[model samples]
Target: MVIMKKMWKNNQARRSVSQLLMAVVAILLLGYLSSFVYFRLDLTADKRYTLSEPTRSLLKDLDKQVFIRVYLEGDMPIGLKRMRRSIKEMLDEMRVVAGSRLAYDFVNPSEEKDARLRQEFHNSLMEKGLKPVDVVESKQEGGTDTRRVFPGVIIHYGSKNIAVNLLSNNPVLSSEENLNQSLQALEYKLMHAISSLVADTVKKVAFVEGHGELGYLDVLDITDELARYYEVYRGFIDTQSPNLDEYAVVIVARPTGKFTEEEKFILDQYIMNGGKVLWLIDAVTVNRDSLSTGETTLALVNETNLEDMLFRYGARVNPVLFKDLQCALIPVNTAPAGEQPRFVPAPWPYYPLLAPRKDHPITRNLNFIKAEYSGTIDTVGTSQAVRKTVLLVSSRYARLVRVPSFISLRQIDEKPVQEEYNQSFQTVSLLMEGKFQSVFTHRMTGKYALPPGKTFREQSLPTAMIVVADGDLIRNEVRGRGSNPHPLPLGYDRYMQQTFGNKDFLMNAVNYLTDDAGLMPLRVRELRLLLLDRARIMESGTFWKTCNLVAPVLLVVLFGVLVNIIRKRKYGRPEKFG
Candidate 1:
């Protein structure tokens, strides 16, 4: 009897030791996991995330202390409320990512709109050099309107401020894949925008002038936003051309007059000096100054021959009109005198809203480059020459019209089938990167001074973009002044009630051309992936069955079996699990 009692005591001691060991291991394992996870999964899929690297870096190097006053209070739009949660998630991520390098304070501007608080926000905008975007009172539910003020985010590094505009019309949210891609890009965009604003190296982009090019007002109206990122300047290279090396990139936008040999030579020299050019040229004359079309009219085909300069580089802009069945409709035939409209504007055949390719940094997030009177661009590959990529294209059924006479918006029709129509796709926009011979290398013209640089020809010139298709959609169709958008870009369908993508497109292109840091501009992220195969929905039954009936029964059976095993183990019976 005494021996039996001693055996029981020994077993009890062993069991207690094992339980203690298990508890200690559980605690250590959990501690290790908690270190890696700083932020919780609190954001919704409808929102996003990013960090301001400039503010972060400055806090470490310059030791600058910054403050941000977010004017969001009261109730948020349901969508915006979800966004607020996402913003918190992103802010937490930034805090963890920056560690001791940054500190910030989030504030509510509705605190009585007090003089001190209002003054603080205004002072921050001025002192930090941030752009101040006004918030408009818009219509809400219940026959009432509400006044709300907010922007995407703001970063203050030293005295420089980088304000990010998040709310824009996004057409891509139509596709889940596209939305995922864009979110991926958002991270890098936030990083680069903030960093570039604070970086020591300032980039200069000059608009080439004196050849009847589009004036600064034409683009600066839009590029004033650009001036914030690049040093915008007016540049010309006649015989009186100044130092071409002053700029990192030169812009040539719709230069109507012919280029004098000397003038062309100076530009050629600039390219040889490692300067990049963003050539937004049009082969066909588009009457953007016409009436009824908001000064925009489309026409086609010319041999005013720019190929002499471009062909040597392996890409040529053809003066052919691109027509397609898949096109935007403009009202052609309206409702008769007192009847519902019987005829709608048939696709204008030529204004092929060139669909952007899913690949490539520039056109990846780019959609329907809303251009009118666009021309076909031909790319001919060569050896010991530059590389070319088609950033935009029309549908496979697209037709090209050759010029015999002037064609108006009403002259569009289906073209006869041709081999070119079925054979291959035509390129609308191209990228060129390689050597180029100076147009004035063989000819001496006194019109130009001894070139901007020593080189007569550029050998292996840097990469640059040449968009042959005109940016006709760039015309401010919506009539709004200040920062408030007037009418939003027409939706892809009526269901897409957001406007972020269109604005993002312009901003993304500018970022791609100037910053090409492979920051994943087109990639996006999507969490809460719930893919319910509709084919099996009926078979899976309703939520109540799946969550309550079926799940509970399975759990109860599992619990009963587990209890039985434990009970048997306590009594020293043969263990079922073992």
Candidate 2:
């Protein structure tokens, strides 16, 4: 009987061990299979956690490692802390798609105890093109403390490194709104940096130089900025055998002279072949230098002769100047001459500060774009094949000055009625996309002779173009002596000491036009920020505090009691065996 009991216990022990081993084996097999499959659920209402398709594809196709150094670290404000968290989460998601190829680190450059070391670090970062932002923190018992922080990232891939500014600041937006816009743009900025660094071949862009367009010196600032991404070329289009097809984008910046029929035909053919163009044409011409003479200058319509071509493409640059109440200030000489003149900043109605459209990707979250004698743009044609979007527009308090009107600096002294400046939302810049009908379609065979092996395309392939009614949008201000002039940054007003959004607006326009992978659409992603009313919060602070502190615990206790009661009813019954 003792042997039988011992044998039975041993058998039971063996059965238990066998079952345990099988269970372990099954768990291991399940885990191994799961390693090959990937799945995730994003519960965010705005789909903030979800990676864009372009981003995912870019990550998955990475052949080599991409190292990122994020400088948004250490002690920071709640806003910055949240930005850091979002960046980390984005990088984590990227890593999943890119596997071990995408690596990143959060670095705190201000952590150095040595002042000299910290200064050197900051200088190095600045040299690497990372702009530092001054962060001011209000102390509980003191005034405030200021610290310099770089909310930027450096992306390294292969033999290249590109710096990306993560903070998108708009002077028009509130601090919170600016931070939210920056957060919204985080993905595009990072992806753009990555794409720029990883590009295998450099794309080509050309600035059409003939026909009295803005000279090389005038556009030097934007050219310098664009050279980072494209192999920029400055030359006249060869109308005899137009080789414009070699370039991805062509810029006609403020062409003052008329384009010959042959040249226009060549340009039209280029557009028909899916070529992109940025037309910064001035409809009304006014010599701004004449304003310095203290005399009125006649602002006449500029005759480029490309109006017909542009009209066929879906927009018209009207020969009317826009005057906005919200405009840049110029330092007017309020004092008499000979003595030191007191230059006071006065609003120059001719120099309208345009607001970017919030609905479009090209202008979303952009700051005010300064314009000098800019004209209005009117969308034409009712073609379903063409889509036009107003990218920049004047404010509600705007007025239109028809061509042949005189512009004088003395007008700044005149206090105009606000009711007179009631022309609202006048379009100044437009983006046109889709298949464009060639201006020389039927005329090519009849009037213009086509080269051998060349065929006239009546309709264009899918393409895009931007039309700005102001030529000065692409022109930069020059400083220094007359013999050796140096270009100031584009959209910079020396008198006001402010930088506008002309450079960014133009860059984004070109980027959108040349982008083949549709990455520019990523700029439209928006994350809405829900903020509490500060006044209400302060007024009902105790009531809210009590609810936040006690509500969860009370709910937990209620749930426990309900579960216990259900359990008692479910299993606390006397069982009768059959």
**TM-scores for all predictions:** 0.72, 0.87
* Ten contiguous residues minimizing lDDT sum, candidate 1: 491-500
TM-score leader: 2
Off by over 4 Å in 2: 1-40, 139-143, 444-453, 481-486, 494-497, 550-578
* Model 2, backbone clash pairs (residues 3+ apart or across chains), number: 0
Cα lDDT tens digits, model 1, 465-542, are 555555443332444645864543422222222332223444455566666444543243334434557778777667
lDDT of 2 by residue, 1-578 (tens): 65765666668668868999999999999999988766669998999889899999998888899999999999888888888998998888888899999999999989999999999999999888798999998999999988888999989998888788898777777888988998888888888878877887778899997799998889999998888778899998776666888899999999999998988888888899899999999998897778776678899999998999999899999999988999998778788867787778889988899999987889988889999899999999999999888899999999988879988889997998999999999999999999999887656355554445667888999999999999999889888838899999999888777789999999999899888666888898988889889999999988999999999999999999999998677545444435
Q: Judged by lDDT, which candidate is best?
A: 2
